[model samples]
Target: MSDRHFSHEVWLSKLRDHLTEERYAARTSRQCIAVARHFLRCLDKQKVDVSTAQPASVEAYLQQTRRMYRRRHGHPTDYKGWQCLHTNGIHMLLRLVQGLWPPAPKAVTPVEILQSEMRGEYAQWMAGQRGLAPGTVSHRCCEAGRLLDWLGERATREELATLTHLDVDGYLKYRAAAVGRRSLKDVTTKIRSFLRWLYMTERTSRDLSSTVIAPMLYAFESIPSALRSGDVEKILAATRQDCTQKGIRDYAILMLISKYGIRSGEIATLRLDDVDWRQEVIRIRHSKTGAISYLPLLPEVGEAVLKYLQDSRPKTSFREIFIRACAPYRPFRCGSSLYRLVRHRLEAANVITTGKRGPHAFRHARAVSMLRATVSVKDIGDLLGHRAADSTLVYLKLATEDLRAVALEIPTGVKA
Candidate 1:
């Protein structure tokens, strides 16, 4: 707070360089610098502390700008454009100051500091002692922190000796009101794990994990979202007919999942060198399990991919085979991007699929197809990069016809 004065020239110069580096147009850069300079000058005139300036000041300035615009141009159709420039300029300066949208940081208390330390220690235990994946550890640690935050002082190591099942019950009930049955199951499991860890570490007197009851959810209660082979055919056919760059790319992507059962994550992270054309095989590096599996580059999938690479794929130096068709072209960010692409393709093709509509729907469809083909469970599991038998068994829920064929009729003597 001591250095309350903002040197307008110094900050404006920095903002100018930043805007130029970000490729903002010359006029836009000037507008942005002008707004930032105006904000700094306002702070000096009002003797506002730079560290503690309120966001309300930004809104006040914007309101003043709006009035000035009306007086100068009388609410022209394009006045909204100027308004956006003002908003962006103010936000840019604020973000540069705090490294966030908010002007001030929340003052951390002793209890908050303790809570953070506890979460970090728990994360270390989960990662080191349990060998959980990074994503799993982060999620469990976050869930534990949520409980600590909800209980406040009561959740401290010194105070947790008095903790009981009542607190766990209340927390579960509170969370159940917000999330669905399926997501609530994950919450309950994560909360239970935290409670068990706390008791084992001697932070809590009682192990209240068992009391954190989840909602009623039967194992494999719902079948996997499997688009029928015919529906998959329809989607691919629709994309093939379009014959655009995007359509070719979509067809190639669809073939990978529908024919080979490739996971979205694997597709996103697949590198250019992973594909061996001479060997007629593609290497899959699994992130979740750290297992690498090589799959045959089937003629159909390979041909589609070749067409995309030769014609439709962006000319980026990125090693990934697929790239975003738009500017700032880059490989797909993650599995979610793949999900959106598949969903859009499905909707565009007017293919109304059951259960999951994302790329995984085709994966499930492929699994069911293999099962029906009398392919060994081992082969199906290998193709899907499944790490456990239970993971592969989930798709059996979708193999209704096969299940019916193998059904053992109920004995007449055992019937009620």
Candidate 2:
């Protein structure tokens, strides 16, 4: 980017083209170009050459923009959405010209810097030494980060030697108030792992891990959540009707979940090459059991995904099939992002269910549908990638109505 390009109108044409590719409305594009023109005029008056302008100078111009416009620009639909759009429009231009839009990360304190370094080390140890899966490592690291955050200034390695059992108990007690019993138990487990690592590395004077105990758990305590027979269809129908970019991507995702009962992580991690158009099948790698299954590509699903890939998906170099529908386009951040997407779609479609409500709900729902269709238990196990036959049996617990049909009549001689 020549400084002259910024000062000149050469990049304005490029900015307009970029906005059009991103699906910006004609009105919004005009507003953006107008803002860019105004900005260049201001820079000219200030005797600041546009070609050689500093980022700080551009930031100053953006800062003064707030003074020119009022809070409510009288937009009826979005209610203050214009303010955000204006900022975003100008940012788009800056990103187009400079490429490094944000410039740099926010400054961090010494304690914070050390905290991040230790977390990275812990993640590496979990993956390299323990050979844990990526998902397990990520979850454990997040829990450990929580403990370190609670410790605040005392989180550094040298301070580990100064820690005591009271700190462990206090942290657990603090966490207990916010999470369910199962989550608290997981937190305790996460803490013990971190403490053990510290002791093994000789950072801690003693094994404080022995002091951390897990909470009790009951067997078969809660029912697994699932959507009704029609709920999944409702969500799919609603999403399928939406031809927007995000809708197209989300519809493809819902198709995978509903049709094959694959886990969200599998969908998020699915690469473009995973789909075999000639073979008419999609490859699914189980996120939990690490098993791989090839499912036949139903025409409906293949068509939906094909439409998204061709029409709406942003042009990105990511091998992942599903990309986010916004600027700074990227793949979903893993299962949790997909979970949020599914949950929102479920809620928006006015579908409700009790118990666990993430992508697992869709998986369980698929299982129930299979059961209702008289799918053999072995077939269910095979489709869902369950290593243990007993795992497939768990879904039978949710088929209360189907089970009732198979109940044998009790003999009169038998006692209640």
**Deviating ranges (above 4 Å) for candidate 1:** 1-107, 129-131, 152-159, 200-202, 215-219, 243-245, 404-416
Poorly placed runs, candidate 2 (over 4 Å): 1-68, 71-83, 86-110, 113-117, 133-138, 156-159, 237-252, 306-333, 339-349, 355-358, 405-416
lDDT of 2 at 332: 85
Query: For candidate 1, what is the total of clashing residue pairs?
Result: 0
Clashes of 2: 1
* Per-prediction TM-score: 0.77, 0.74
lDDT (Cα, 0-100) at 348 in candidate 1: 86
335-406, model 2: which lDDT tens digit per residue?
Answer: 888877888888878887767768888889999999999999999999999998878887888899978989
Per residue, candidate 1 scores C-alpha lDDT tens digits across 1-416 of 33433355656677777776665678878888888777776777677744456787777777776777779887743656767877788787777766778643343888888888788899999999999989999999989988988898786667887898888888888888899999999999999899899899888888888888788988778777899889999999988886889889989999998988978888888888999999999998876677999988999999999999999997767899888876446899997898888988999899986578998899899999998998888889888888887788888888898899899989888955
Which residue pairs does candidate 2 place in steric collision? 3-51
Residue 277 accuracy (lDDT) in model 1: 98
Clashing pairs in 1: none
Write down the TM-score for model 1: 0.77
